[model samples]
Target: MSSDVLVCQGISKSYGEGEQKEQVLSRVDLTFQKGQASVLIGPSGSGKTTLLSILGCLLAPSEGELIINSEAVNFKDKSSLTEVRRLKLGFIFQHAQLLPFLTIKENLVVFARNTGMQADDIEQRIQLLIERLQLVAMAPKFPSQLSGGQRQRVAIARALLHRPSIVLADEPTAALDWHNGQTVVELLLDQARVEQAVLVVVTHDVRMLPLFDRILAIENGIVQVKQNVK
Candidate 1:
């Protein structure tokens, strides 16, 4: 297996077709090392999210190869792609996307089941997630019962519940105010390190850039590492 947790080689994405096609990413190559936090920053419509989607196996690049968790990706095979996404990658979007009708614990169970986790000691796992994410009191509560930050925390816990090897977050703090954003960023950084999973976050906010191991700048379909703090 490769040492890198996620690899993107000559990746490119285009919308439309032929002369009408617009290229969003142009031959981008990116590799994320295990247990490292990589921050991707770019202006709006700069293809930051597009690249992230490719890296997370949520979208297939028009050209190039993406390897996640040392597995060579076969995008044409839906089952393989689905398996990789379920078993290896965890995603946290701008919204929590928690099931509104289910309780916090139930939401986690849904995630675990999709990830193919064994049923043994499921409650123990849920309790640990609750404690780790400081969501203990909200475990029995529904998504509607929590604040924005708390909901996002539950989302983060759900992402980590499967013990995925990598986490891809898209503007996780975009919806929160400054203080809440900072708190969520700190929690993500802390948990990613503790879980030893490769963490990639795409956002325009510069406030949290210093906390990342490296900052990847994306502009007009071009990507370059602006700083390597590692």
Candidate 2:
């Protein structure tokens, strides 16, 4: 069986048209397989987040095919894309974005529920994830009650709560200090490995570059594989 989770062929992204057109990505070819941790590094306005968004199904690429878990994304069909985003993909943003009114466990459960997982199954998975994330004691607490690290952990737990096949993180550790940042990255790596999911992270923290399996440096919308420091 093929282990590939994501494949991008001749991927190009642009805005506007003709005279006003702006090309952000050009002929970017890439492949990400299960259990691989890939990091994207780039300068500001280098299309890192744009490419991530396109990969996450939040945005449509102007040209080329994006295959996720072997299913081609039909940009013309919003519902098809929504189904892919909901059932197969997971996203972790720089902010935890947990609802203030919901408890830590509740925040995670809501997603699983929305994804149509059964009640008992949801509970079972959330319990295990929160335990692994060490958020067991903090389950009943709200987002504001937890520290930055704790909140990011909860965010991670939430993202993985539904057991998606591919995980995309956008600057996940950008806000924390080194210690907390590394801790978050380690936890993400460990859980991603356990789940056998493809993990792609975007980061500006050069100090954490050595942790990823591969490094993709982007500048002016072009992606170049720098090195596999792992």
Q: Pick the candidate with the highest TM-score.
A: 2
Q: Score each candidate by Cα lDDT.
A: 0.88, 0.90
Question: Which 10 residues in a row give candidate 1 its minimum summed lDDT?
Answer: 116-125
Superposed Cα deviation of residue 219, candidate 1 (Å):
0.8
For candidate 1, the per-residue lDDT at 168 reads 89
Candidate with top lDDT is 2
What are the models' TM-scores?
0.96, 0.97
Q: What is the Cα-based TM-score of model 2?
A: 0.97
In model 1, the Cα lDDT at residue 56 comes to 77
The digit string of per-residue lDDT tens for model 2 on 128-150 reads 99899999999999999999889
* Candidate 2 deviant stretches above 4 angstroms: none
